[model samples]
Each structure stands twice: as C-alpha cells, then as structure tokens.
Target: MPDFPFDAETHRRRRERFLQETGGGVAIFCALPELVKSRDTEIRYRPDSDLFYLTGFTEPGTVAVLTPHDEEHGFTLFVRPRNPEREVWDGPRAGPEGARERFGATAAYPIAELDERLKGLLEPADAIFYTLGSDAAMDRRVTELLRGFRLTRPRSGKGPADVRDPSIILDRMRTIKEPGELDQIRASAAIAARAHAAAMRMARPGIGEWELEARVESTFRASGPTAGTAFPTIVGSGTNATVLHYVDNARRTEDGDLVLIDAGAALGLYCSDITRTFPVSGRFTPAQREVYEVVLAAEEAAIAAIKPGAPFTDIHEAARRVLVQGMIDFGLVTGTVDEVIEAKAHQRFFMHQTSHFLGLDVHDVGAYATADGSPVPLEPGMVLTVEPGLYIPAADDVPERFRGIGIRIEDDIIVTPDGHEVITRAVPVNPDEVEALVGTEQAHTETQRHGGEG
Candidate 1:
C-alpha cells in the first residue's frame, strides 16, 4: 500500500475535535460521486474537500459515520467491497476490511449495506450533522432514513430532532491549518511558483496562449505531488486579460500586449493560487508599466496589513484605497480617493475583493463575517491570497494609453504570530525583475539555436 500524506492519528484527532464541537451528535459525510461525462466516459474523480479533510480516503462511493460520545463504536466507515472483476476495469478499492485496518475505523461494512445499517445508527441519535444539498441521491437516502426514524419515534422514543450542517464546525476547524497542512500548502506554492516561472520563460510575441498553458501544466504535473491542477489554468492575453475567469486559452500573443496567467498546482490536496501579468515581448511598455505598478502597490499594501487580530476587511480596504487613489491620479475618475470609494466609483476597474481564504479549495471554506455580520479578525494558521488588479476596457471613456491594459499581481500569504509570509514569492513580480527574467530566457533560447547551427 502507498504511504498516505497524513497518518491515521491525524484523522482521529480531527474526528475527536468535531465531536467535541458538536457536543453529542451523529455526523455523516459522503464522498463525491462519479459523474458521467459522455455515453460511457466519466470525468476524473476528485474527492470532496470536506470528506477528504476528515477522512483521507479518496475513493468514490465511500461514506463515513461518526457517532460522538458512543462508548461502543465512535467511527464507522462504509466502503466498496473488493472484487476481482471491478478491480480489473477500475482501480483497486480499499474494501471494508482495508478501511478498518488502514483508516482506523472502529467498524466497517460494504457500501451495499449502507441503507439497511444506516437506519439503525440514526435511530439512537439526538442530533444529526450532515451536509445538505450536496449529492441529490445521498440527500434522498438520508431524508428517507430520517423519515422512517421519525415515523417510528412514537414508540421507540428515539431519532434526531435537530438537523445541522456539519460545515458549521468543520469549516472552523479547517480554517486553522495544522503544521502538516501548512507543509502541504507550502509545497503546493513552491510547485506553482516554478510552473509560473516556466510560463514566463516560454512566453513570446508569436506564441499561442495555449502553448503557455501547456508548459505551465506540464511542469506542474511533472513535479509530482499527485500532479493535479488546483483549477482550470487561465492564460489570457491582451484584451482577453480584461475578462476575469477567462479560461479559453486560444488567443495568440501580440507585441505590446500584456498576458495574465492565473494558474496553480495542488500538492497533497492543498492548493496554491497565483496570478502574474507580464509583457509578451519580455519587457513592459510604458502604459503597461504604469498600470502594473499600481496593481503591485495595491497588492503590497494588502499583504502588509495581514497580521493576527487584524480585521479581515482591513486588507481589502488597504488595497482599495491604493487602487482608488491610483485611479484618481491617472484621471480615470473625477472625485477624490475617499469620495470615489464612497461613491463606489472604483468598481469600473478594480472589482473583486483583495483576499479570500485559500486551502484545499482555491476559494476555501471559512466564514468571512462574524455573528453580527462584521468582518472576522485574522488568526494564526490562516492562509489567504492577496490579489489586486486593474482592468481597463477599450472604450471612449477610458484614457487611450491605459485602455485595453489589464494587470494583476497576486501571491499566497500565510498569517503568522507577528506578521505574514508570502509562499509564492519565487516568481518575480517586480517590474525590473520580471523584465530581466524573461529577457534572459529569450536570449538563452536564441543563443542555443545559433550554437546548434554552428
């Protein structure tokens, strides 16, 4: 058997914490079901983030049940049974016996027995903790089980009365990363940094956008660590850069155009998201440089404000202030910085929030606001992304020099005791540094070609 990234004890501690947080309840988690892509094909299987966080098992059709405060058995797992025929088509399964032996489950059973056995488990629970509206099939099954239990409650005096979403407790626990989780995230950042660097080196005026995407993705996969992309790679160039979340990487790069590549890699299920915009010709034009500098300054301001106990909104405010002031200075807006911000005038260029919780999911779990709907304070072990961008459309209202120029600078940051650390700092974001890096690579490629001819 392959060595898992996390040990069994780590999962045990997580389950214990979940139980304590929920007091005494039966918490159920279902793994992601396989989705069909075509008549006989299926999309690649990726485990659900929440399920994988609590239990490291990645196979489909697996379900985990946690009975807190139960003396006999606190953890039970239902897994696919081992079969030679199925193993021939698909890969091998952990099976019920392997689940008990490898995953530290107190009891294990074949998944075929879930419907029959789950009812008995639900009959004695006072409260149920499950993720609702996730899997429709699983949702129906759970509802039917609860309905049966409720119908029999007249005589047995059992079954849960309260149903709560497990994310309430699970999200909080996941917000604070453990040392192991940090290590995984840091490794992911390192791989993504290298991939971005590769993309920068390969970018040229005549290259197709998909070529750069291929280079970055190949580097990510070749570097190991399960070799998966955190999300679809974004390699937008020129006018395409203005569209946020643009994944159609089919455009060709042109001279004097800026390319924005927002891509990341996953290592041990942790993700690293990064975005860097650089000139396709290896040096930024005067117009591109001006906008790039503003976005970089905004990103820096946001990152500098990240500290323990600081309100989460502080980061966004710092970035917004810088961006609004830049817009005023560039004559993009008429009002003063404060006036523009108050009047919501900056949304024309700088739109999205400066930061988001980053972890297993690119936009990871965790509530941004408190009970009263105020921004939550930062805490140690929390990881986030500091991304600030400026996008100018080619319109009559926009200044001709800055029009059609979109630039964004982003980095992955981790909150620490005294300050914060940028894990994705390997790639150059400074204008001069980026120019030199790309120029050096371009020169090297030309020299190699001449040398080969000689």
Candidate 2:
C-alpha cells in the first residue's frame, strides 16, 4: 500500500533469487481468498505472504506462474478481469493489461483462462512447485487441473511429473533479512514501540482494556494511513493475563492489576511483535515486583544469548533456567533448579517457549532446526522475538501473595555479526523506568494539547 517500501527492481531481484534457489522449477502461487466476516460483510483481505513476497500483487483471484530463467514469458499472471459492474461495487482491479504494464508480467490473462493456460505452462516443466490444501476450492481446482494434465500427457509427453511446495526455497530465503526487509521491520518496530509507550502512559486504574487496545492501534494508524496492526492487540488484565492468548478486552482493570499488552504493527508488509506488562496503579505491589523481577531477569538473559552462531535453543535455555530458579527461590517449587527443570516443575508457571521467528507473519516461518532436528545456528540478519513470561495462578499450591499474577517481557531482536540489536527498546523494560513511566505523562500531554495552561 504505501508504494511498497521496495522498488519493482527489488521485487524482480527477489523473484530471480527464488528462481535460482528452486533450480528452475515451475511454480504457481495464489493470492489468499477473501473471507466472509458476517452473512454478507467481508473481512479485510491480506495477500498471501508467499505470493506478495514474489509478485507484490495484492489482489484476490490472482495467480502467478513462474518459470525460472525463461525471461520472455518467464513471469506470467492470471488475474480477475476488470468489470465496470464489479468496479462500482468493490474497487477497481488491475486487469490483465495493467498486470502486464505495471507489474512486469510477461504474459497476462483473465483468471478464468488459468485452467486453459496452465497446461501450456506446465507442458515444458518436469517438476512443479505449488502449495496444496491451503484453500479448499483452489485445491479442488488444482487437483482437477493435474488430472487433466495427466490425461493429456501422451499429447505433450513433457508434462509436469513432480510437485513440491515452493516454500522449500522461499522459507530459507526469508530466513535471512535483506537490507530492505530489515528496514521495513525496523520501521514497524519503531512505530510499535511508540504505541506501547503511549499505552503505558495512558494506563491507570479503572481503564478499559479495550481503550488501551484502541490507543495502541491508533498510534500505529496515526503513524500513517498504511501503517497498521500485525495482529489483534492483546490487552489482558489481572488474572486474565495468566491466559496465554487472552484477547477478550472486555474487563475493566482494577487498582493493583497488571495489564499485559502483546501487540505489534504492520508497516510496509513487515511486522513487529512486542509485549509489556504495566501496573494499573502505576506501581507494582511487592509480590508483583518480586515475580516481575524474575521474569525480567529471564528476558534479559535470553536476549543476551542472541548472537551470531548461537544455537536457537540457547535463548530458551537461558530464560528457562532463571525462571526455574525463581520458582525455587519463591518457594513455589521445592527442588533445586536443575532438579525442577528436569521434572518440568517450571511449566506450571512458564509454559510457552521463549522465542519465535518474527517477520511478515507474526509467528513467521523459517525452520528453527535442521533436517535431523538440531537447533539452527543464528546468523547475521536473522530476526526473532525474545519473550520470557511467568504466570502464577491463584491455587492452593501457589504462595498467596504471588498468586493471580502474570508478567511477560518481550523485545524484537536482529542478529548482527557481532551480536544482536534490540529494536523495541524504545519502550522501557527496566522495572524502575516502567514504574516511573506509567500514568505520569498523560496529564502533561493533555495540558499541552489544551494550549499549555499551567
């Protein structure tokens, strides 16, 4: 939307790299279909990340056919034909003509012609790359096309015989951030950081979780019309924070509550994921501070372990050890840290993994391990999220003061040659800074907005 952060040539280079990696296989990628939100209303459509990565076309009912190194007609597009009738109702489409003129398609045709055109395209290919089973209707159409191709094989004698997922190459390519991709990721992180800070300052007892959600996302949109959310903003408060994916921001936060916000922004199609917990009363209770400090230490340790050549597991291991020790120190568990870790006693308080690859998709795809299930070594340009959390439920087994508390600290990290750089540090993670930040700036901000009256 914001004139994609990269130029057409950049997109072409990516396609070229993809072609080189796939070893000249014929590949087809479809844009994701629009979904019905209600009986008649449709949800906002986002292009399939894979298709958008290669073609930069963001329209439904569109397919890209790529033949490595063929040049003259190597990149072909089949798109929905423009219709004045549909145009007046839905927006204008980039018809086949526009596809060729603007999108660098060597050949373009109506999507209705895909079934007829695909045969010719595949006749010369030995191996075809396409993801199956993603869209049911599309899957049926593709299988039917394959059946037709198989039946017609005698006539062509060179039809595609092997099929594989294009992600075989695409995923590995996406693992390392290109300079432009990192720029977009950093920009998104910057915007999200500001949004988090705004949420922190606006936090106060009696605030609605939905209001904070709005404030964070509005900060994203306020950055630019095209800048937006990476995922639904999560604003879980008090005991709700214990629920890992709690998103129903329907409750009002009471004093002494800790509101956890896990949110991000999508700018130029790249994403940023960040989470921070704040005290509704602007200062954590002693019990809350004790658990918060433990989680913070784990987060800092995990992030410190992110550097080039470190196994991805090191990040989790570093965080996990501290949390296990904390459970022992706080008397939530009885055994030694190693003993508890071996028994997985820490799972009661910390259940999720410490980090995940973060990129175009929030839980972005890139193999975390090699074929034999060994941790992938971190390389420069690889981006990930380092998050450490502790959720203690109000149960008889838990210490009364520490119960019903949850704290998670997260930051986006970029692996550099020397070490890692945290892009989301714009929002303070230090306990003292966090306490000092909460609910302190809102009054000053309001006063300044109303002509700076003393």
Candidate 3:
C-alpha cells in the first residue's frame, strides 16, 4: 500500500473540529468490519472512507470515541490487540499501543473493553453522536449502552440526555478539500489518466471489451502500485455505452463503433474519475465525430462554469444547453431548442447529468449551501467531475443514420478562486486530439506488443 496520505496531526484536527461542532458529545465511529467469503476466507479489507479520513488508520474493526473529558486532552481509540500467530498468517496490525502512539489517541484500549468503557465515556456527556444502524452489531452495542444509560438514575444536575449522529457535522467538513487532500486526488487523477490512455492505445476493432479492461487495469498498476480503479471500469463498446454503468465487458469491438470508457483510480482513498469515448478503428466516422464534438463542447462549457461561488447547477444546465441544441441542429429532433429544453427532449439521446462532487468517495459529501441553509456556494478546495454525454440507441427515433452511438467526455476538476483547475487535463478532450492520441503513435507501439492492436 502507498504511504499514508493523511498526517496524524490532520486526523487529530479533524476529530477536534468534530468535537467542537458537536459541543460536548461522545461521538463513536467504527472502522468497517471485514466480511467472510466463506467459513474462514475473508474478502479483501477496505476501511470505510470516513473512518480513514478521520483516523488515517486502515485496520478493520477498530473503533474510536471522542468524549468531553478527552476534549481537553484527546480522543480514545479502541483497537484489536496484536497476536503473533495472526500476524504470521496475515500481516502486522496497529494494536492498542500502536494506535495510541501512532494515531495520537489520548487513551487506547482493547476493542473487547468497548462495552465496559463506553458507559464511562457517555455518562457525563450531553449527546452520543454516532452513525445510526450502519453496523447491526455495533448498533446493538450502542443500543445496549443507551438502554443501560436510560435505566441509570440521573444525577441531580448532571446526566446525558440525547443521542445524535455526528455525521451531520463531519459531512460538512468533508465537502471541502484540504491542500493535502487535493494533492492526493491529483495523484489519483494522474493514475486514472494513464489508465484511460492505455485503454485508448490498445483499442481495436476485434478486441473484446475485457481486453480494454486489462489495458485499463494494467495502466493503473504501471502508474504506481496504488489502490486499484476507484470503481469498476465501464469498458462498453458501441451500443453498450448507452447502458450507463456497463461493466460486463463481454462485447467485441467492431468497425465504426465508439468505446465509452468511464473509469478512475483511487489512491489513499482519494479518487480521480474520468471518461473518454473513442473510435475502435482509431478514427471517428463523420456521424460519430459530429455527436462526439457536441458532447465535447458541453464538457468544455460545463468546465468553464466551475468557478468558486458559482452554483454547480449552473454548470449542469450549461452543458445541457449545448446538447439540447445539437439534437435540433442534427435533425435528430424537430423542435425549438427552448421547447426541447423544457420538454427534456435531450433525455432521449442524453440522459445523465453533467457533473457530481468528487473526492474521498467518487461522490464525496460536502455542504452545497450557505450558512442560512441554501445551496452551498462553491469554494476553493472543492473537486467535482464534469461529464457530458450523448447516447443514441438504435431505436425508431426519427433517424436511422443517427442510431446506436454513445459519446461522453469527463474530467476531474477543482474549483479555483478565479476559475477551476482541470485536474485530469492530461487526458485530452478535443475530438481531434483524441483521434490523434488514439489514432496511431506510442500507444500502438506498446499495445501491439500485447496483441491488443489489430
């Protein structure tokens, strides 16, 4: 695994901020548990993004409690203790002692002590903030603690009264990216660009979609031994691209087809999402080029609107305008652009929106409002994806010549004070650039060795 992207000090500050936001609550957060594949086999462990964001610790089954008493000091972390036998079979664990020393936990205890220690931590608190019902086992434990608290008598003037979820406090914090977080996301985006570039280079008329998947995955590995693609790659060719989240990758590429690849790479939980549509034969036919150009224009228009203080909804609408007009100009639909926009006639060929928040989760949580509870104003440190697409399925929709074609262009972007930074700019968006990039060059030299080129 790559070195930890977050610092211990950052994790400490995050917890402190949450505590301050919650006033005086005992907030409980548990690292997600590893699931069993069978009797003993376990699926690969991936720590929850929120847990990792606050703790910088990736071990599963670890839990933490930020309490009032520790507000003056620090939070306490409860972790699984290390076992020599288990370590030999699996790997080293950051046990209780390591958690305290390395993770800056004020107090560290074995996870086995949670039931006993939790009551003590919650006794004098005002509220208990937790993620409700996320883990049934953890939920039961919290219920038991709350039940016991309810049964216990209140001191004359001192006893806990409420249980609330602290996620409301944390989600707002996560929406804005920090300088370090941007660096991690940029790294992830760079890796994602390489993967997309690899797939484009290896594409050919006879290649199976799985071959493109291999190219994408291999590019991620080659870029750096980081977390794999942030999500399963959509390596759809021709009509499959219209399916949106296409992942089967079973179809074979053919002449005069477009391959829509929606993929990204994850590094230290930070993600970079990108999409590009290219011709299987390395050159877009006239009909494909016409539609691809419109989507590209929409992508650029959306990207241009992503400035600090701008409403993201504006960008979405901006992209939609270009696509709606294109459908009219191409005679794909018969109506005024304004009428089509109102009727959402573009939904036939362009169904999805233009962008979404991007970060720790592909769609990271952040406030999209101001202090008065309106839509969150965009600000520096926010990252998002600008993807604009046009999908024309082989349907009896007015024209047979403009059927079964799909094209989309996406890039990871960070809002800047004056403008927005295209983080995934390394992946070209111009149709001419895309053709030139995928047409023939070093890509062919590399993929030809792998027998990916026809």
TM-score to native of every candidate shown: 0.97, 0.96, 0.93
User: Candidate 3's error at 98, in angstroms?
Assistant: 0.5
Better model by TM-score, 1 or 2? 1
Q: What TM-score should be assigned to candidate 2?
A: 0.96
Instruction: Determine which window of 10 residues in candidate 1 has minimal summed lDDT.
Output: 1-10
lDDT for each of the candidates?
Answer: 0.88, 0.88, 0.82
Better of 2 and 3 by TM-score: 2
Model 1 stretches with alpha carbons more than 4 Å out? 1-3, 452-454
Q: What order do candidates take by TM-score, descending?
A: 1, 2, 3
Candidate 1 per-residue C-alpha lDDT over 114-176 given as tens digits, one digit per residue, 9 for 90 to 100: 888887776678888988888787789788877877798889898887679999999999999
lDDT of 3 by residue, 156-228 (tens): 3444676687768888788788899999999999988978877777777888999889888778766655567
Clashing pairs in 3: 175-366, 368-375, 368-376, 369-375, 369-376
